[model samples]
Target: MAEIAVVAISVAKPGHEELLREALEGIVGPTRKEAGVLQYDLHRDVQEPRRFVFVERWESQDALAAHAQSAHIQAYKKAAADWIEHAEIRVVSKIA
Candidate 1:
């Protein structure tokens, strides 16, 4: 099966940029250690400080499903609920 790539974009609520970034950063270490994680990277927008993105690759759809249900991800959702203003997640497969 082909690998799955995910791009997750998050925007922090006005004054909560720092808190959102910290919360997002906290999950990186643990997420990378997951069974089917191939790559996991976090990036901040140069022009928009409150915007953050996650670039991730997983071995398969099942792996990605597991990631979604992981405890750390669940915790992050709860922790950043009030701090985040918007979030968009996309999963795609490479064509070439």
Candidate 2:
């Protein structure tokens, strides 16, 4: 199976940037240690400080599914939900 890549963008509510950032950062360490996690990176938009992005690569669909069900991810969702004004997530395949 080919690898899976995920691009997730989160926009924090006004005055909630730091809180959302902390919640997002908290998942990095554990996610990197998960099985089949080729890459799991978090980025903050330079021009838009309230925007956060996650660039992730997984070994397979199963791996990606596992990641979605991870305890840390669940926690992040709970912690960031209220602070997030909106979110966009895309899963893609590498054609190159």
Candidate 3:
């Protein structure tokens, strides 16, 4: 089995927590249902309203690459177009 871990940190527009949550729901929901996905989770900081994180595990790099091409992911990008301030995504391999 292949494992892929990712962290996405993003800052959204002020008063956009609800919007961000909706976007995240779209992301997490579909991502979890992805063919190669094993885990997908969302996180938020209690003290930080605009900060969000997503943790995902896929079957392989090819699976992750396929996730990038999904229509829902595209919609997520479009829905978050102007609201997202900055995003940092990382793909990691766990140490055995």
Candidate 4:
């Protein structure tokens, strides 16, 4: 199966930027250790400090699905729910 790339964008609620950031950062180390995870990186917007993006690459769609079900991800979702105002995830395929 072809690899999959995911772009996850999260917007923190006002006054909760640092809290959200910390929660997001906590997932990085554990997520990177998961099977089939090619890359897992987090980025914060320079102008919009409350916005965070996670760029991830997986070996396959199944791998990505497994990642979604992982404990760390579930924990992140629960922990971030209160602090995040908006969240979006896009799974894309490479064209070139």
Candidate 5:
């Protein structure tokens, strides 16, 4: 089966960019060490400093589901909830 690809985007509320970034960054190390993580990268928008993105690849749907329920992920979500202006997450497959 093809790896699962996920793109998660978040925009920080004004004045909370740094906090949001910190919250997002806190998950990288732990996530990278997860059982089925093929790749997990975080990026900040060059033109829009307040925006953050995570590009991730998982071995399967179950892996992704496990990731979503991870303690770190839940903590990040809770910590950044008030600081986020908008959020979007997409799961896709690479066909190219």
Candidate 6:
């Protein structure tokens, strides 16, 4: 179980920025309310609007798995599917 996860997502579509933002923004509330999530932050690329990064902390890998199956996350996925160019997700154990 990873205690932390750093997700680097890149959306390739030129016109899908709004969709991506909506999807990312939509999941924030639900993720914050989740029991497993300790912290979550979304970063948008200033130079490249298509690139986005999500830094997330969880109690454990189990918690992360739970987040993956969350309804809000699912809905966001659906909404942003067409706009997603690629998703690069990585889970890492917290050192601290």
Runs with alpha carbons beyond 4 Å of true place in candidate 1: none
Candidate with better TM-score, 2 vs 3:
2
TM-score of 2: 0.97
How much lDDT does each candidate structure score?
Answer: 0.96, 0.94, 0.85, 0.96, 0.94, 0.81
Candidate order, lDDT descending: 1, 4, 2, 5, 3, 6
Error of 6 at 16 (Å): 0.5
In model 4, the runs with Cα more than 4 Å from the true position are: none
Residue 42, candidate 2: alpha-carbon lDDT: 98
- Model 1 lDDT at residue 51: 96
Worst 10 residues of 5 by lDDT: 1-10
Model 3 residue 82 CA deviation in Å: 0.6
Measured against the true structure, the TM-scores of the candidates, in listed sequence, are 0.98, 0.97, 0.90, 0.98, 0.96, 0.88
lDDT of 4 at 48: 98
TM-score of 6: 0.88
How many clashes in each candidate? 0, 0, 0, 0, 0, 0
The residue-by-residue lDDT of candidate 6 on 7-63, one tens digit each, is 657564788887788788878888999988888988898998888888888888888
lDDT at 57, model 6: 83
| True lDDT of residue 40, candidate 5 | 94
